[model samples]
Target chain A: MPENSAGTLAPPPAAKPKIKPPRRFAGTLYRGREGMWSWVLHRITGIAIYFFLLVHILDTSIVRISPQAYNGVINEYKTPLMGLGELALVIAIGFHALNGLRIILIDFWSVGARHQRLMFVIVILLWIVLVAGFAPRQIMNIILEAQGHGSA
Target chain B: MTTETIPAPRSSYTPPRKRRVNWEKWGWLYMRVSGLFLVVLIFGHLFVNLVSGAGVRAIDFAFVAGKWADPFWMVWDTLMLVLALIHGANGMRTVTNDYAHRPILRKTLLGAILVSTVVLLVLGILVIYTFDPCPSNAIAGTLPAFCKAH
Candidate 1:
C-alpha cells in the first residue's frame, strides 16, 4: 500500500444508506395525549353546544307556537334533574372558554407551552368561581322554596 | 440456466433513537381522553333535556324553574358547563394552530374564540343563577302556582 493510502482507504468505505422508519400513529386524530385530548374535547363540546343550540331555539320557539306549550317546556327546565343539566351547561361553557384562552396563547403567541400547567390551574380556578357564583343562588332558592319561602 | 451468486451477509443494522421530546404524543392523548368524557356529558345532557318525560314537550319556563329548585342539579349543570366549554375551546385551539398559519390571523381568531366563549359563559351562569321562574305581581296564569307564597 502507498504511504498515503490511508487517505484513499477505499474512501473509508461508503456510508450505509439511511432507512426511513415505519410510520407512527400515536397522535393521529388528536388522540395521542393529554393536550390533544383537550383539543378533542373542545371540538366535541363545540359541536354539542351547537346541537343544543338548535334544540334550545326550537324549544323556546314554542313561545311563538303556543304559550301553554311554552310554559309546559319551561316548567320542565325547573325540575331538580334539569336544574343540574343547566349547571353542567354553565361549566361546559366555562371550561371551553378557559381552555380556549390557553389555546389562543398557544396559537397566537409562544407563551402557552411555557405555562401549560399554570393555565390549566387558572382554568380550574375560574371554574370554581363560576360554581361559587351560581351554585349558592340555586341551592338557596331551592332551600327557600322547600321551606315555603320560595322567591321563584 | 446461468445465475448470479448471492453475496454473504454483513453486520446487522441497528437503528438510532433521537433524544428529542415529542409534543405531538401529548396532543393525541388529549383528544381521546377529552372525547371520552364529552360523550358522557353530551349524551347525559341530551337525554335529560330532550328525552326524559314527555320528550321535548315537557320543557318550558316552569319546567326549568322546577329543575332549578334542587341544589344537586345546580352542581351537576355547573360541572357539565365547565367541562364542555373547556373541551370545546381546546379543540378549536388545535384547529386554529394547525390551519391558521399567519400570526396575526391566528391571534385574532383565537382572541375572538376566547372572548366569545368567556362572555357566553358569564351570561349563561348569570342566567342560571338569577333565573326567576315567577316574578312578583305576575298574572295568575303566568306564574307557577308556588310563586303565590313569595
Candidate 2:
C-alpha cells in the first residue's frame, strides 16, 4: 500500500460509485423506440401464435377420435366470436411473418442493417394492405351469417 | 513445504479466450431456414382449407379425412407439424431468455414450452397416421356421407 508524506499509511481514496442496472420494467416496457417496440411485438405475437397452434393441433386431432366430436369443435369456429379470433390470429401471423422477413434481411444483408427502419415501415404498409384485403370480407360474412341472411 | 513467498503482481489481466459451441449461431440459422419453409407450408395449408373449392364450408370432418387419406398430404402435414413446433419453441426459448429475469421462472416457462411442443407434435403425428376416416363403430347419423358409401 502507498504511504502518505508523513510515512504513515493513508486512508484509501473513496471508492468509485457503483453503477446501477436499469430497472427491468423501464428497460423493457417504457422504451418506445421502433426497434424496441418491434422486438416486444414479435415476442407477444410469437407466444400468441404458439398457443393458437396448440389449440389448432388438439382440435384437428379430434377428427381422428370421432367425426361428431370433431364437427362439434369445427362448427363452433363459424360463430362471430371465433371469426374475430381468427381475424386476430391472421393479423398476428401476418406481422410475425413480415417482421421475421425483415429480421432475416437485417441479419444476412449488409444493406438491410442501414435501412432497417425503412424495412419496418414497408412491413407495416404491407400488413395494412393484407388486413384491409382480408378483414372486411371475413367480417361481412360473419355478420351476414349472424343475421341469418347468409350461409353458415 | 517451503516458506510462503510473495508473488509479483502482473501488469494487466486479460481473460483467456476459449472456443465454445455456438448454439445461438445455429439457432439463428435454423430460424431463417424454418421460417422460409413455414411460409410455404402455412400458406398452402390456408389456401387449400379456406380458399379452395367450397372455401371454409368445405372444411368438415370429411374434408380433413379426405386430405389425410392422401399420402402426400399426410407427409405435408407431418412435416409442417414437426418443423413449426420446433421453430416456434426455439423462438419462445429466445424470448424467455431475453425477458424472464428469475432463473426458476425462466426454467419453468421453457420446460412448459418444451413439454407442450413435444406432446402436441406426438399427438399431431398420431392423428395424421392413425386417422380412421370411416370407422365401423361410428354411429349411423354421425358418419360422413362418404363413409356411408364405403
Candidate 3:
C-alpha cells in the first residue's frame, strides 16, 4: 500500500515477466536444474515401473495354471538375460521408491521445500546404496544359476 | 431476522450437477498413501525374495508354496498386490492426462488402464486367496515341508 514520493499509489511490477512466444519453438521453463531433472526421472521411472507391473502380474498368474507350468515359465526368468533385466528392474524400482519418499517429505514437511535439492541428492545416494547392496548378491545368484549349481 | 439476499444469475444459469466426490483429490491422496505402504511392503518383499539366501534361484514352486502356506504371508501378498496395482494405475493415469492430448486417444488410454487395473486386481486377489499351496498329485520331494503327507 506504500505510495511513491511523487503522489498516488502505484502497483508494483508484474509478478513475473510475461513469456513471449517464439516464432519457432525453443525450450521451456523446464530449464530448472535439479528439481526439473528429478521430476523428469520420477516420471520416466514411474512409467517404466507401471508397465513392468502389468507384465509382472500376468507372469505371476502363471502360477494358476499348474506347478509345472509355473516353473516352466519362471525358470526362464533365471537365465542370464532375464537376470540382467531383473537387475535393471531393481534399479528402476529403487529410484522410484527413494525419490517417491523425497516427494512425500517435500509435500508434508515444513522445511522440505527449502532443502529439496539436497533431498534429491539424498534420494540418489539411498538408491545407489540400495542397488549396491542387492546387485552383487543377485549377480552371484545369476552366475551360480547359469553354471548349474542351483541346488535349490 | 435479516438475511443477506443472493443475486440471481445475470444470464441464463445452468444448475450444477450433483457434487459428491472429488475424484482428482482422491487420486492425489491415494498416490501418497499407497506409495508409503508400497515402499515398506515392496522393500520387504524384495529382501525376502531376492536378497535372502540363494536369491532368485531359490524361487520356484516350492519356495512360493512354502511362503503362501502361512496365512500371514498370504495376507501380506494380497495387500501388496492390491495397493501396488492401484498406485501404478493412478500414476499412469496422471501421465496419460499430461501427454495424451487427443481427446479420443486419452479416453481410450484411460479406459484401457482402468480395465487392466480392475482385471489384474481381480486376478491377483483370486490367485492369492484360492491358491492351493499343496497339490495332491505333487511328487513327494517337490512339496514344501509344510504340506501334509508329502
Q: Which ten residues in a row are the worst by lDDT in model 2 chain A?
A: A23-32
In terms of docking quality, model 3 is medium
lDDT of 2 by residue, A120-148 (tens): 89989999998887687667656765766
Against the true structure, whose lDDT is highest?
3
lDDT string for model 1 (B3-94, tens) is 98877688567698777868677655555555556556655665675435543334455655667677766666666565555556666677
The predicted structure with the larger lDDT, 1 or 2, is 2
Q: Can you write out model 3's per-residue Cα lDDT over A81-141, one digit (the tens) per residue?
A: 9998889988999999998888888889999877788888899889889899989998999
Runs in model 1 with CA error above 4 Å? A1-152, B1-37, B137-140
CAPRI accuracy category, model 2: acceptable
- Backbone clashes (count) for model 1: 59
Query: What ordering of candidates by lDDT runs from best to worst?
Result: 3, 2, 1
lDDT of 3 at B23: 89
Compare the candidates by DockQ and give the number of the best one.
3
Per residue, candidate 3 scores C-alpha lDDT tens digits across B1-150 of: 899888876867779889889988888888899999999999899899888888889888788888887899989999999999999998888889999999999999999999999999999989888888787656556666777664
Taking all chains together, each candidate's TM-score versus the true structure is 0.44, 0.78, 0.82
Two-chain complex of model 1, DockQ on C-alpha atoms against the true structure: 0.07
